[model samples]
Target: MKKNQEIKKSLAEILELPKDIVLDIPKITMVGNLQLYIENHKGILEYSNTRIRINTKSGVLRVIGKNLLLKSIVVEEMVIVGEIHQVEFTD
Candidate 1:
């Protein structure tokens, strides 16, 4: 697995490609404190008004804040919008 990752990393660097895409990892983007987008997600593990936990290739992505709403969700991506305060990853 480590060797495969190393190869992928080298390939990404050589081709000027995104590592996240090459490694099949989640890509997270945030805009101020209003919204967040999680790409390449596995699935949503938990959801509530204040928190949302998304499963990914790396780990469980925990989003914490107020008025957390799942604005959109799909097979490969998800969109979260609210007063996002913190984002973390856990095993």
Candidate 2:
């Protein structure tokens, strides 16, 4: 796995491509502290008022906030709206 990641990183640098796009990793976008957009997600692992966990190609994405709501969800992307406090990825 480490070798694969190293290869992908090198490829990304050589090709001048975004690593997330090249490696099929999740792209997370945050809007202020109220909303978040996650692209290239695999699925939702968990959801709740204060927390949400999403599965992606890279790892498990965890969203921590208050009044968390899954505004939209599809196969390729998801939009979360709330008072977002922290976002992290875990293996």
Candidate 3:
């Protein structure tokens, strides 16, 4: 698996392709501390007013903050809105 990942990374760099798309990884985007956009996620693991855990291809993405809300969810992406304080990943 690691070898395959390395090959994909090399190919993406050599071809000037987007790594997230090439590697099938989650693309995380934040708008200030109020909103977050996660693309290519597997699913939502846990959610609450103060915390959210999302399943991604690489690992579990944990979002911590206040007044958290799942603003949007689709097959390929999710939008989280609130006062985001921290984000972490764990395998």
Q: Highest lDDT: which candidate?
A: 3
lDDT (10s digit) by residue, model 3, range 1-91: 9999999999999999999999999999999999999999999989999999999988999999999999999999999999999999988
Q: In model 1, which range of ten residues has the least summed lDDT?
A: 69-78
Candidate 3 is scored at a TM of 0.95
lDDT of each: 0.93, 0.92, 0.97
Which pairs of residues have clashing backbones in candidate 1?
A: none
Candidate 2: stretches off by over 4 Å: none
Best first by lDDT, ranked: 3, 1, 2
lDDT of 2 by residue, 1-91 (tens): 9899889999999999998888988898999999999999999989999989999988899999999998988888899999999998899
lDDT of 1 by residue, 12-56 (tens): 999999888899999999999999999999998999989999999
Candidate RMSDs in Å, in order, are: 1.1, 1.2, 0.8
Question: Could you tell me the lDDT of residue 64 within candidate 2?
Answer: 94
Model 2 clashing residue pairs (backbone): none
Higher-lDDT candidate of 1 and 2: 1
* Backbone N/Cα/C clashes per model: 0, 0, 0
